[model samples]
Structures are given as structure tokens and as C-alpha cells.
Target chain A: MPDRVLRLQRIARATAVRAPARRPVMIAIAGDSAAGKTTLSGGLATLLGPGRVTTICVDDYHRYDREERRKLPFTALHPDCNYIGIMEQHLQLLATGEPILKPVYDHRTGQLARPELVCPGDFVIAEGLLPLHTKLARACFDIAVYLDPPEEIRRRWKIDRGVGKRGYDKHQVEAELQRREQESADFIRPQREYADVVVRFAPISEREDPPGTPLSAKLLLRPTIRHPDLSKVLAGDRRWTIHLKLDREENGRPVDALHIHGYAPREDSQEVEKAIWAQLGLEPGDPIHTLGHLANGERSEPLAITQLILLYHMLDESR
Target chain B: MPDRVLRLQRIARATAVRAPARRPVMIAIAGDSAAGKTTLSGGLATLLGPGRVTTICVDDYHRYDREERRKLPFTALHPDCNYIGIMEQHLQLLATGEPILKPVYDHRTGQLARPELVCPGDFVIAEGLLPLHTKLARACFDIAVYLDPPEEIRRRWKIDRGVGKRGYDKHQVEAELQRREQESADFIRPQREYADVVVRFAPISEREDPPGTPLSAKLLLRPTIRHPDLSKVLAGDRRWTIHLKLDREENGRPVDALHIHGYAPREDSQEVEKAIWAQLGLEPGDPIHTLGHLANGERSEPLAITQLILLYHMLDESR
Candidate 1:
């Protein structure tokens, strides 16, 4: 065997014995600000139940305050704006079930708050812009997800969140979005390639749906890991409520595309949730009502389903 | 009130004392030949249970047998080729819960079989190419549906069914499709505008899915009747699995477009189903597995959902 393969095998064996077998399963949810990382992670934490999951926001690793960030040439999306090395170390620690004094960033005042102690529980959800930016950081996760909402939707969400929660007006949010565009394109989107699953939320095109229609979701499931068999749900029947298609090849490798229709009937959404729950050997009545939505309490069926898929990976790894 | 309103009210009061204060609800499923009418109606019949629903194939109203049809200048889709007057009378009789001696056409041998006595059950499904071709016929239905599968997919299905079941080869089926094109366009397509629901099934575009990937469906719910309130399932949340959008207005009237994603997770489909069921005040455990698919045993989620929607109307009318 090649040296690299032998080394990887040894590491895998070690990891099987030490990490997943004895430690909490760690998931990395990487996305730009207001890209729904908190919502995704919080839902997973809820699904796993209270005290069973711990969440860490890597944006806390920002070395400069928001005001200081304004004076810097680079935006918060850049590696230099964050303590990337320390974030990598903490992620590795959390993956191995260790605790750390995690820093906190208060978006309300754009200041760094006092550090708080965090313990790894049965699961750890690390979410923020830079969680998967480094190879070492990527290696620390049992499962990794990237939230890739459309720029326009993300901007709208950011503006809404900024005004409502962080005391920023629409103009400031718009300016910030423009300022971060270059860094985001350079640093954020590339992380999606490293994720096991990439979720994009957007509206269906070419129609004037009434305002408040749910956003549709497109999930790109990479071949990095095995996903549950949805053949029974997705195959043989025409007129399915959820569509799974083989996406155009990426770098000559095929990927599966799962499109969860927005405004899908509750029964249809429940069917999908049950299929996924069955894969996890979970009971049917556990109430998955909390999985898909933002922190603002806006619900999304695709986000819920996407989070469930990631949870499946974590459970598989732990087992 | 207008004189017509007063007369109609009096007639309604008299009819209530005499007629369908207890009559079978009638549903019309109209489409071109090979448009999946049998599959759709059979599923609904199954859903409503065995002895409760009666199905009538209006193709039985053909004025001529297959050999005789071949001698005529018009195709089966043409009104001149069918017993339109008799069909209208039979539909009216069925709507009023009366029995009729309905004709039978043996699709296998292309011959007219002996007429059979059909009694109106608690529910009657009239499925064929021209059930909604006339205003009187349309009025006889409590609910009307038109299957509008894309031409290419319909063609493939036709060729497959022709070869496998009807004992026709590929070339013959192709020739028949060609022969029927003009009449189908002129007569069959027009019925869609008259339907309360129009269902179209096709593969998701821009991707090559595995052969068994379920076909997605688009349902145009015309505002001819009040549909179940899907507001909870479709509105508020931005990420739904079943999407209901405002269709481009038809004849300056707004309609709702319900798109059921094929290959949707079973959970998502169930959510949709449950929402509709809730609207109908139905218990969640009622089995709905039999609602979608063809007589050939092919299944479609959208078809099932579509049938469920129609069933809702029937149940509503019956109540």
C-alpha cells in the first residue's frame, strides 16, 4: 500500500477508537454571516435534545471588534480578520471531547465579550464563516455542511436581522454586504467545496408567487460519505413531492441533487422527515417540527431536512 | 334577488327533498387517450374503497369500433367520432345517481364489447378523453381533472403501454400518435381550460437522473372552486418541500400552481397529504397509498396528491 494510504488507515483506526467511539460527534456548519448557520445548528441541538449538544460560534474568534474591522483593509470574511489558528485548535479539541474557554462576539455592540467555558457533550455543532476554511479544521468534523443561500436572499436576511437585532439600518447592511463581497467570494464560497453537504435556499424562478411563499432548497450531496438510501421514496413513482436528480458533474465527478420543494404539503414534508428518521432508527412521533428555520423563527422545510441529513451522518459516525 | 336566483333557489329546495340529499358524488377525469386517466381514476377508486366508488370509461361512448374508426375521416378525439349526445345524457343521469347501460370498448382487440349495467355507487369517476367536452357534461361533475403530461413523456408511455399490453409494435404506435395529433390538439387540449384541476407530469429538467427517478408534477388549481386552504403549509415558511405559487393569470383570473416535487422525501409528501387531509377533517391514519399511478401499476406522488385533492372535493360535496 502507498505510504499515504497506510497512514490514513492508521489514523482512521485511531480515530475509530479514540474520537467517535469515546467522544462527542462534532459537526462543522460553515457559512457567511446571517447565512443561517445558527438556525441550522440550533435545530440540530434541539433534535438531539437538551444538554446533549453544545454549539460553538467560530465568529467569536474575530481578533478585531466591528469598529476596528471597518478600519482594516480586509473584511471579516478574510482569515486575517479571525484567529484561524486558535479556531482550528479549539475545533480539534471539541472533536476529541475536550473543553475550551471560547470567546464571545456580541454583534449587538460589535465588541468582544467575556470568554465562557464550554464542554463537549454528546454532540458539538461548530458554526460560522471559517469553520471549514483550513484542512486541519475540516479534518476535525465528523460531518460538515455549508449554507449557500443566494446572495440576494442572504442580503435581505442580513438587512432584516441587522435592523431588527443588531441595531443597524438597511443602508449600513447594504454597504457592509458590498464591502464584504470580495472577501466573501474569495474566502467563503470556496469552503463549500470541502463540505459533505451544500445547501442553497432560494425562491423558485419565473413566477410571481404571493409574498411569503416558502423558499425552495437545493442540496448537493457530495460523495465524501454514504447517505441514506432514498430509493423507495424517490424512485419508480412519477409525481414525487421531493425530487432527487443527478446534478451536472463537478470536476468530472457526479453529485446527487435533492430538491425539496417549498410550500410542499405538510404530509409530503412529514413523509420525507419520516423516511430520514427511519434511517436513523428514530421513533416516528418525535416531532421534527423544530428542525428547519432561522433564529428569527421563520421556518424552512429544506433547512430542516438538510440538518436531519447531517445529523444522520453524525449518528452513523458515532455508531 | 333576481328572478333567476329565486327560481334556482326553489329548484334547489325541491331537489334537496327529492334527489342528492343522497346521491353519489361524480368526478370527471378527462384527458387524451394515453394521458393516464385510468391510473388516476383507479387510484381514487381504491382510496375511497372497493364497493363505494364506480368508474365509467367514457371512451365507451365511441360511435364506432376500431375498424370502423379507421374507416372514418375523424380521429377518436374528434367529437364527430364519439356519441357526444349519449355521453352527455349518461353523465347527467350518473350525476343524478341513476343507472345506465354503458358501452365497453376492448382496447386489446380494438372492438366494441357488450354493454354492461353500471349502478351509481356512493362515488362515480368518469374518466376518458372527452368527459368535459360539453357544457352539460361539465355541469354533471362535482370535480373535474385533466391530465396534461408532457408530449414526449406521454409518447414514451404510450409506446411502452402499446407494446406491452395492447400487442402493438413501436411503429404502429408511432403512426397512431401521428394520426391522432391534430384531433387531440383541437379537441383534447381545450378541455384543460374547463377543468378545476390540471395535472402535468414530467422529469425535472437540466439533469440526468437515474432511470427510476420519479417524475415531478405541476398542478394548476383553477379558481373554479374553493380548494383546501394550504396557507399553513405554503405560506409563512420560506423553505417548504411542496410549493404553491400563483400561476400566471388565465383569462385575467388568478390561479394557484401547486408543484409536487418528484422523488421528494416521503416525509415532505406526507406533510402535503396531511395538510390536505386536515383541510378535509380526515383522520391521519386513513391509507392514501393507492391514489397515484396507472392501471399498468406505475405510481406517481403528484398523481396521488392530485387525486387526494379531487377526493377532498368529492367528500366535501357528499357531506
Candidate 2:
């Protein structure tokens, strides 16, 4: 037997779970349903390369199916409606770079399906409704992000994504959103306080952009974790590209808010990407084109820049 | 948080999976289809009581469903038909008293069903067709048992079990049995070499018993593990109930052959039970009547004694 497996045997006999020497870096991308979490996590995973990244949707731990949740008084976002203990346990396992047989909550059927065996790789992107639900689950991540799109944008995205496709209508989704609002407020949004980065993608309210323009991105980078030095990206002659300003949060703590315009010229976004990519000390070529693709085949420069920064964090941690 | 969970947290940060202080006792009851693995394991689990035993069927790790297997050349019994690595991984996890979301193979619909989360209790009964098929899987158990019902009896049990209920005609079932026999010989029966106990329930060939007579049991207890001393049960005037004698295995090695007659009177089997129960030193109340029950409600004295001896092994392990 290989020495690693033999070590595992010794650990099992010792009545203790000992892991291998290599541990994967953990990243959490948390947000409400239809919050573009899939887009972000999938993009990051793609950049990390196949078999080198394990993408875990923590929602697979839901305690009930969609129909079952309809019967309960609370929404699925509530901690009581999911197997948080199992989530915490699995997170702990993955954090230690071990394998897990993760449950598959099939969204197409609105039910839980057979699980699949998942072995963690060099990086794990655990994205879903409640990956950041508990303190224990939160502690597993080296980088935590919360998607905080304004309520109106999120509502529009939900309606646009589900209407006529999920057997849901505009009014029904609106009502469902209204019903979930309390649990969302009580459980989901509060996770933003713990995130190292908070991202909001929406149209600047004062501007009336063209109908087809992508939403811009505003990332509030907290000092909780060492973030990439965006000084060069925000440096000279980049006013048309991005703006970095100090902003006071509700708790009166100042945070660095890095804003990137969705309508920035392709050259400007690529230039910004090059700056961050350079700091990562990669060999020549940039993996820029692989980062910001939406599932529907549309592209967003703001989304690309957001992923680049996250990619930087993951690479920095690995280094 | 408890001190144990705190220890787990530390292990995770250290990039290794160090387990808690306690581990489960693993028992492998391996046999062919309809060869009484479930009956034996269920009886022991019932004796052990609720929330203290996790029953795992290694068949859950099958790589293909019944429909999918129809197009393949090999029987489901072949090692190539299942996820052996995942099965071994889960067994290691359970052996260390951890939790796993085990896959589910639904026999009724001949399809794979959703998986479930399984937490190991103090005792884990991992009974299935191929649990002891590999050196790795065999190494996970503290006590290994192989059910070796005579070929005639196993065939009869399969036919009786499948004939009207499973949409199986007598001819079709016989053909299936003939088909599985090669794989059974190649992969299944060979596992007996690795078991601590080899149990075979069959009527003695020389005796012409009446129709519907319960089968007697012959247990080949190997010295791979310390078995409880059955001197008192075989001592004195209990010859009519059970016979213990020195036997030579096919390998020409000495083994203890413990035979209990199914036709023995209830009081005689009860005497054998008391002897083993006294050795276990459990609660004062005997839990005797609870053993030896078939799913259809028939009772077998020989079966009860077999369970009693296994129960002793498990309780002894915990001690």
C-alpha cells in the first residue's frame, strides 16, 4: 500500500481521523437563490482547471424538498430547514482535504437525488444558500464572499430566470419572494457581516444606460483578509476603467469599495486583468477570457474583474 | 463546543482529518443473495438496540443500475460493477466512527435512488455481497462472517425468495442462479477464506428429515479473533442441543466446529443462550426471545444460538 493510505489506516485504528499532508484552499460564495453564485463559482472553478477544483453547493444539505418546504412555516433559507450539522461536518472534512459523499439536491425535480462521492482537490469553491450559515461552516473558508445585489435587481433576476421555465409565473415568483423575504432577512443577508468581500452588481440608480448594457460591480473589500493590492489597477489614467474610494459602513467602519464599470472598454478591463494577473506571478499567458462567462453565453467585464480578484486570493493562499 | 469537536477543528486547520476519541466496532456479515445475511444482521442489530448500530449495505456503491447492467457482460456481483474505492473509503470513515452520505441502490425499481446520511453507532453491521471481497474492505472489520449455506439450500432459498414476488418465473430464476454461480465462485465464495466465522445452515445430508423441518446450523469458528468460551453450553448434558468438537478445515488447520440443532427443544436452545449471555455480562434480563426470528415470523433455535454467539462477540468487543 502507498504510504499515505497506510497513514490513513493507522489514523483509523487510532480512533482518530487523520488527513493527508496536502490541504485544499477553501472559498465560499454565498447569496440568495438566483444570485449568480453559480456563475461566479463556476467561473472560478474553470480558471482553477478540471479535477483541480471541487465545487460544493452547500444547499445539498436542505432538510426538505421544495414541496416539503411549502408545507413548513419557514422557508428553505432558515437554518432549521437544513442539515447544518452534516454541513458543518462535511465542510470540516473538505477543509482538511478529505473526500465526502455529497448529497445532490436536484433543482430540476425539486427533490434530493442520489449522492456522489467527491474528493477535494487543490481548491474547493463551496457556494450556495447557506455555506456561511453557521460559525463552524464559516470557519472552514479561507476566503468568504457574499453577493449583495439590491433587492430590485435580485427580484428581477429571479423572475427572469424562473418565469415560464420553472412552471412559475411573474406574479407567483413575486409572491414567493415576498414570502421568503423574512427568512432571507433573518438568515441569509446577515451572513454579509462575516464576508471578507461583499459584491453588488446593479445599474447605478442615477444613470439611464442602454437596455442591453451589463450591470456594473461594486466590491467592498474588508480588511478581514489580505486582499490584492488594486493600487495599480486604480492607478494613473484609469478613471474610465475603475474607481476606488473609502466608504463608511453602517457600523461606521471604513471599507475600501472598488468599483468597475460594466461599460468599460474591452481594452481597459483587459488592462486591469493584466495588472492583477501580473501580481499573481503566473507564467506569461492570461486566463482572462475564461473567467466571466454567464451560463446563457453572455459576457460581462465586471464579472470577469471580480473573478480575477478572487482568483488572486486563491492563488495567494496557495503560494 | 465539546472538547472533541474542538479537537476536530484543530485537525482540520492542520490539513489532516484526525478523528474523535471513539471508533465503532465493525461487523461484516457477507453472503450470497437470499442466503440470510439480512436476517442474521437484523437480529444482531435488534439485539444491539436503536441509535447504537449503523447498518450499511456495500451494494449501495454499485456503479450501474439494473437497467444499465443489462447491457453489460458482467453480473452485479463482479468487482468491476461497483465503486470499490468509494466503498473502501466509506468503510474507513465508518470504522473511525464518522458520518457518510452513502449512495442508495433501490432494488424494487431496479434503479439507483437518492442517498442518505449515515452516522456510525457504537456497532456497525456492514452486510452485503462483496464487503469482504477485497483485502482493503476486509481490513475494516473487527469481526468478519461469511454465510456458507450449502449450494442446494442457497438455490432453494433464492427460488423461494424470488419466485412470485420479483416477477421471476421458476425457470428464469433458475437460469439467473446458474448465471450468478460462476461469479459467485470467482468472487463471492472465496471471501470465506478471510472471515473470522463461517456459518452454514443446512440439514445434515445423511438424515432424512420430514418436509418443512428447520435446518440445523454448523458454525466454523476460526481463531482469527478471540471467541467466547462455549464450554459450559457444550459441557454437562447439553449434547442433544449443541455439539462442540475439534474439526480439521480444508486447509488442514484445526478449527472449532460448533453445531446446534434446529430441531432441538426450545429449553435446550435457551440453555445455550444463557451460557453465552452470561459471558456477555449485559443487563440481567436475557433478550433471548428477540433473536432467531425470520421476516415471515418463523423461529429457528439454531438461528437464535448463532445470533447469541455473534452478539457475544460484539459485546465483548465493546468491553
On lDDT, the candidate that comes out on top is: 2
Predicted candidate 1 versus true structure: per-residue lDDT over B149-211, tens digit per residue: 999888998998899887889999999999999999999999999999888888767567578
Docking class of 1: incorrect
Residue A175 lDDT (model 2): 89
RMSD of 1: 31.6
- What candidate 1 gets wrong by more than 4 Å, as runs, is A1-21, A206-210, A235-239, B1-319
Tens-place lDDT per residue, model 2, B244-285, is: 879999999889999888777788788778777777776658
Error (Å) of candidate 2 at residue B276 is 3.4
Report the C-alpha lDDT of model 2 over A1-319, residue by residue, as the tens digit. Answer: 1332465576444533333335788899999988889988888888779678999899998878898998899988899988887788788877766677788898888898877777889998999999887777888888999999998888888898888458788899998899999999999999999999999998866678788878899999999899887777788798777888899999999899988888778788878877777777875574667888976789988898899889989988877
Top candidate, metric DockQ: 2
Please report how far candidate 2 places residue B168 from its true position, in Å: 0.7
Error of 2 at A104 (Å): 1.4
Q: lDDT (CA) for every model shown? A: 0.77, 0.84
In the order shown, the candidates' DockQ scores are 0.00, 0.32
For candidate 2 chain B, which ten residues in a row score worst on lDDT? B12-21
CA lDDT for candidate 1: 0.77
TM-score of 1: 0.46
